[model samples]
Target chain A: MATLKVLVTGEDHAQGPEDADVTLVEYGDYECPHCGRAYPIVKQVQKHFGKRLRFVFRNFPLSEMHPHAEAAAEVAEFAGAQGKFWEMHDRLFENQERLGEALFLDLDKELKLSATAMRQALAQKTFEARVRADFTGGVRSGVNGTPTFFINGQRHNGSFDFDALVSAIQQVMITAKSA
Target chain B: MAQSGASKVTPIHSDRILPAGAGAPNFTLHATPDQTLTLSDLLGRPVILAFYPADWSPVCGDQMALYNEILPEFQKFGAELLGVSVDGAWCHAAFAESRHLHFPLLADFEPKGAVAQQYGAYRDADGFCDRALFVIDKKGIIAWSYCSPVAVNPGADGILEALEDLPK
Candidate 1:
């Protein structure tokens, strides 16, 4: 089985308790349709598991296919620098179909982040290296497609729909508790 | 009809891909209508040859797109990736344009699967190349090779591992 090459650290954008019973890492592209479909399903899974799950998000943009993916990731990282990573991440996916400079600036205004700084950072590609590092980590971890999940460090090869993900996470939680 | 006793049977070679440590077969193929890329020209850099069945196919599209995304990672190791298929240059050009692929998709269309045949990656039954990957070192020797099931998209983990294992 493929294992996570990069463990979750202070650098990752995480939610819930760090010492939760399960860690769910997702490698996702901002503009991927499949990832867009998975967005709500992941939210449901998180709600179902609540405090038992530690969710981590990593950028795995396929820039070739999705023209705005890298820039969107940079926008999220820009928000992250301002302590609003999850907010920007949610907004990006929520408006995935309208990803562009206009939407990014709008999101900046909505999130109360400085639009000028966001534009300058995007123009200079400030967060490019960080996004690329996440991408490289995903490649090393055997991620061939967007929205690849790792349940407690092991690659999740099954479907990422609500029921499948919940059952898989439950299985992991059981295994961890027993051990 | 009378059957001859003690008739001799001839053995046929299976469609087995070239194994690791074998010298990579060199060839010149069209990367575009005007440009031709020779394997020997890329002697000093590690090369990844991804032979897929065709362009526009679902599995092949995902495989190529995955490679396209991780191209920078390959470049960090000074590795060049070339996708090979029996599609014509025009077909490859259209597909690459639609997908925004940065790497060249070499067209093996002139003799139709000649290079794939040399590497034993040609699927005679299907009249196309099989899903195969070869990591050739800087010295033009295959460091590793794998043939995946046609329906599956073999991820880049094996390719990256082979590149990492190559002598620096």
Candidate 2:
């Protein structure tokens, strides 16, 4: 996370549109409780910034401690293929414990994804590579903890609180607008 | 806030920590092949006892990644790095796979916080071990040891330096 500010350029980024005013890229672990706690703050940033900001999720699972983190990313990836990656991402983070491999398949059906296809994807280790790539990029980005953020190409490493996020964004917005 | 340094650290009451120059004590932990590895088993080789605060903390991530990067060096020096935490073996396997990490994340679960307590690294209120590193020489005597606050850490290079300084 400390190195995030220097890592804005990389092959692992998920691009938004050309004219997006603010691009918020996050390096996060699925099972890190701190990441879970940051979920709401990120949501608020999206709310506060609205269409002016583009938010991206980068998976940085701390699988060493939380065995279910990578699978959780896969569930989101599976849902992504069905055009619901964000939906599934939010769902998995909101209820991480309930989304193990068994629970993931169940939720796939709940989210209207093809359970058979989803299972196949998981079996094929489809998004495993993508998750790895993101994690490796996270390493390159100096991401060591959950919910590491880059607000407009600058890293913010501190407590996972929303007020902190809002202030950072507000300061950036004023500076960007003035410039 | 928790007390800093020696006065605040009492492993037996909380995590069971061993002070420097003391015996590393005997304990069994789950290794990479899913086998139980004991401190006594690694007696013949110099051991790098890596204590990370948690599996995914940022500093901890850098610390383990650093060790993985220097695995060959450690092996050349005839050493084994054993990471201990409250996390389970199952989590360790996934952790290794995800990071392409080439080390073992020993499970200090069950007996709850016994090993961490033994090392005086556990913070009972937080339910996690603090960052601590110990280098035990081949004879099973601690040669060098260092501990850090939960958020900050001393780099792995210092331990490697200590290892080189310790009698090989």
Highest DockQ against the true fold, candidate: 1
Q: Candidate 1: where is the Cα deviation over 4 Å?
A: A177-179, B1-15
In angstroms, what RMSD does candidate 1 have relative to the true structure? 8.3
How would you encode candidate 1's per-residue C-alpha lDDT over A1-179 as one tens digit per residue?
Answer: 57899999999999989999999999999999889988899899999999999999999989888899999999999999999999999999999999999999999999999999999999999999999899988888888687788999998876788887899899999999999
- lDDT of all predictions, in order shown? 0.89, 0.71
Tens-place lDDT per residue, model 2, A1-179, is 13442344444334455456777788776777777878888888788877777778888776666678887887787687667878788888888656587778767778888888877887899989888777665555545456667787765644446777787777778889999
Clashes of 2: 19
Q: How displaced is residue B74 in candidate 2, in Å?
A: 12
